[model samples]
Target: MNIPKQRIKISLAMVMPALVSLSILMTMSIMFYIQYKNEKRSLYNNTMSLNLSSAQKMAVTIEALFSGMRQSLRASANNPAIEASAASDQKELQVIFDLMLQSSPYFNSVFWADQAGTIRVVSPVGNNLNQDRLKTEGTTEALQERKSYISAPYRTPAGRWIVLASEPIFDSSGKYHGMIGGTIYLEENNILHRIFGSGAGNGKESYSYIVDSGGRLLYHLDKSRVGENVSSNVVVKRLMGGESGMQRVMNTHGDDYLAGYASVTMNGWGIVMQTSVSSILADVDRNLEEQLRSMLFPIVLMLVIAAYTAARIAAPFTRLYKLTKSVAAGQTVSSEEFRPHWNREADQLNHIMRAAAESLAKQTLSLQQEAVTDPLTGLSNRRELERCLDSWEALRDPYAVLMLDIDHFKSVNDTYGHQTGDQVLKLVAAVMSDDVPKGAVCSRFGGEEFVILLRKHSMDEAYRLAERIRNAILISKTPYLLPLTVSIGVSLYPEHGRSREDVFQAADMALYRAKNEGRNRTIAGVKSA
Candidate 1:
């Protein structure tokens, strides 16, 4: 080996071409393999995106269909004639239910049940009237949950598969009073058939179906399989357990499938769209083969160019490594700095990094906003209020705190339900926010309680502002309910206390006084400066 040194020293020009040529060929092969992988990855991502979108659309349609049935029952349950549960109004209730059934072709039957679980009044005057439904899980669950419900699909004695949507009725005092519900016959319902059928088009290989949270088949193209138990199927098990995503799993017949599934919002039912694995991969394989052929000539040319300029190649690579390091270290890099003349891969990577940075920035901003904002009322949450208060206190700025609450808010929730109660809060928050000065802040402190800060306002000005807010609430009319009223308590900064806690306590005491004094009025804290 030591004696070979003199022989290995060939002319520099002759050895350089051969050494560079081999190096160029290896580099070109590695780069081509990377591009090949990226193409395949892109194809997979696009296919999965299409599948997920289709699954979401099917899930939304199914959810809306069931929601319509439940909403109809809920609306009818609120009717005074049906709520009375009186024998005298039985004829009127029957007529109302009959009208409901006539309005919606999706419902096979509509009925009202008594507290004893006996179907007292039914539309179309069917033989199922006067039947006891307490033994059934659907009716019993409705009574127990005291809310709206959708049952798993079941086959009736009449050989019809139906899902029940029920709303629990409550008396004036918020006591449970039977339920109002309707039967959604899946066997012949055009709506369900359209939903499952439309997702697949006219394709025989791809299909869509639905199953409940209990893994019971609610809908299927195979008519004989409706109401069958699918709990043993791995995909059904994941869906019933509330997992929503795409998967490649073996079907019952030992065949692989690419399946995308989502949970229906109303009933926790799973909607699945399935296609054969072979069909999905067929196009991908063909496209990949074509890509390899098209890339053959380009790769060969790149190798020649690399052999001629091998000495300069390391410079561009070093520059690219530095650019990538800057990005990884969270520094912004411009795309124009890296021209494709030097390296096309560098240009592509620059664009990708720029897009990623921009997306991350947007997501960070959105998360920050969500953190400080109340979801329901669109006002500052308690955390935001605390932070703003601390900032003001640190600056020693003068401000007024107005503590406000909706009168009889619990009664509203018990009567009209929680959804309406949320609406009431939003209305109050909106009114206060609009009427307040530009620098002022309105926040939801907690349930049924709101706080307002009026900066640079004197005690009398603060009291006047509180009075205006109270008057606005008194005149505000809810869409479905009577006018709402609010009581307010005003506390002045530095006059009541130098700290946030003291001012809050003073405002709380004053709010209690306002509540005691015939309600719907504003009371100011005692001046203590």
Candidate 2:
């Protein structure tokens, strides 16, 4: 009953295209039907992913900006020069304020006010800020709390919408001295606008905005909306309530939008990323009827075309889906994963995701560095030193700890001003940094004080190194012509004392005795066995 082989092959080939083409057409029809039914929901999910990513990115960056401002203020308040120079001695305070502004880009203005809330010194002056009294939320809260604070948004008497980050300055003997405040203008080209502004204005009806706890707009794509109150908006209300999510909602203007929102952890502010529903759904506007009209070729040809078309549409959606998953899971995706997919919508999605991830990575790195680095001296900060101590302690390693204090440092501040005194700190920091071996830490412990940890070094080796550091400081020259000296106290871990704190305490006691004995000498602490 079998037909001849050649005839059978030809018959089967002819029947195959008809069957495949029919199946392809049926599949296309079903896909189009499903798309028509769920297209809005599907598209909304995709756009919401993008919106959420942007909101999270903006919030992280703003939080970092706020953290940097706080760090700068804390460093300023800790400076002894700041404590020494008060009222009518703006020379020293002015110098420190200028340094604060120069070191950090987060502040639009830096100012210092005394205990009575009088703004005494302002850097880059004449910005129309009130120089007489501190009336802003940041200063008021800092003065009340007697600690560092970042205020919510408020309006200055000069009518500037701003957030003030202020730190309470304490004098050397532990009395409340004053506060240092830095202001960030909301409506201007501040860091907020510079960071999240690029998220919108693409003519795609996609935009980003920020709001404080009060639902007052801090940043908006529509310039007019900046500084306006939008608390009544559903998104703002949810954000103020500490809820983060995405939903489709109608704006006050009666336009529908898919919005994603999150709160900034450092400040009680909310960021929103949204896009118009009409614009996104437009991509699905090419009806199945129109697609069917274009598919009237021979069966074989139709099958070929259908395969090509399905691959074209399906590949990009797959990529976008995978990208969304990665971002949601907080997994960093490679740039190579975002190669141009020959589709406009997919490429744009790829670009958005990549840019956000890259920017977030950079900001995270910067924050990590800032958290462990002394801004002025560029040495390991106290936080970093403590972290290192924890690591060494866990490893149960022995090391030498040197406590150094600049002799006559206050006199330097008094004679030449804080600017020159700052030069002295930097000079001392540099001299200590120049000769430290690998696996050692040089950190600024506090004002005019530094700590160096030398791993695997005996007390003798540490004393010699400490002496070199002390001599280097004695020979170093400050910006102003003044003699310099440093007293060093060296202690060996486990030998000097059992615990890290005990070793540090022994070093401090030795340092105290050195200062008592003379102004400039190195003392190796002894522990009774």
Candidate 3:
């Protein structure tokens, strides 16, 4: 049983609006996806920038604290009473330590170590002085240097993680007498707390910390992780190398974060601040979701309008389709002089059908011309040349094909503007097009290059044609201020080879030879015959 063609046409018309709407929706979705990706990238960059700024600020603050502590120690070192008492009675040295500790909130405790590396005095009169409690290696090294030393964060014998700040004391003879030092427990310090507190206030779901020269956590908002060694972390190693930058990392808690680090002014310490990736993209996610919802509303509205317009347009086509179907079914249905609906699209479609039937032959000819012409140069394109070559090969015509290339074309494009480069190409194309013989065909192959096919031409004739084109291009003044030259290579067909591929390959080889022999010259390929 054959279904009526009219019904098929009507069914197609009904579905056309749906297809159009789907295509539009897909296009919009792709565009929206690209926009969302760009927005997410921008957000990630912003998060990195913010983290860097915060890290720098925190580093400055910590450096200032260290500076203040150094200044205080230097002032205490110059006092004759403290220096003299440090070498004598241990109780008198303890009195000096107490004074220094009370003067600064930054110091947890102050102690005096003699030249023998013995902790003679400790401030605040705490536990009994244990000689083993002092780090002999660091104390002896600091006293030997006879200058202030800021030791990297370490675990004290008392089990407290602290940084040691020590300044050497000299006797009246300028001899190294002993060392006075203070302990700064990073855990009790407010630097990490302050940085993380501000970030939290800004609704950032992340934390900040300070790491020592060895990549050991000095101060961290996560108390449990303070003193944890992070030297093996790749990002920490990068930080130790004085590279302050941003990275995405998963912390011990298994949460992904966009972390940024900056080195402190002190030699080997740095601050790292991080924020969660999700928090950074939260705004973009919300905006995209809202945009998707809004896009759906417009798409639905357009689809409804398209459906109504399709129904109105299809009503007249429905009748016309029936008449055409009757004619096709071997029933001589008279051409109905039925008038279409008053809608403009319906009337225009009816006119289109009539025009299409009458102008089919002319349309085909126009399409053929369009296929042959190069849209940019208004010359024959490669497709047209290939078709001509096929026909010429079939006839076994003896001819020559030449390929030409502009020397230093990239230099021209870079030195001059692209507009000037385009003008140069067009000028070359026009010169070559006009210089070739009447029966020969010339085309712009692609950027700064052109090809020519010469009919019934010998190798000498082809070389002469190539030389004329090259000399014409060189002598001709282009719209660009710079002069131009071309390299041309010619190969004769039937003499070179019977096949099109062989002829083109020979021409390409000749072109290479021309380029190697210095540009602005023509080279012809040797023929077998």
Best by lDDT: 2
| lDDT (Cα, tens digit) per residue for candidate 1, span 145-228 | 677877777666666777778888887898887888787677665567755676563343567678888988877887677888
TM-score rank order = 3, 2, 1
Off by over 4 Å in 2: 1-31, 85-89, 136-138, 200-204, 286-529
Assess candidate 3 and give its TM-score to the true structure. 0.58
Residues 1-529, candidate 2, lDDT per residue (tens digit)?
A: 9986664343323333343455456556766787776976788898988888878877888788777778878888787776567644778777877887888788888888878888778886787766777776657776788787777787777777888888888776788877888888787877776766666546448777888988998887666667788888899999999778888878767789999888986678998888998887676666545555576555457567544544556544555555656755767777677777667655655675576567656867899899999999999999999999899889999989999999988988898889988988999988888988888999999999999998889877898898888887777766876668889888988898898889999999899989999969999887936
TM per prediction: 0.44, 0.49, 0.58
Candidate 2: deviation at residue 400, Å?
91
Instruction: Rank by lDDT, highest first.
Output: 2, 1, 3
Clashing pairs in 1: none
The parts of candidate 1 lying over 4 Å away from their true place are: 1-44, 83-86, 89-92, 127-134, 157-159, 173-175, 201-203, 281-529
lDDT of 2: 0.79
Tens-place lDDT digits, model 3, residues 59-171: 78878878887888877777788767755776777777788788766677777777767777778576343655455445556777778898877665666676778888787
| lDDT at 128, model 1 | 52
Residue 85, candidate 3: alpha-carbon lDDT: 75
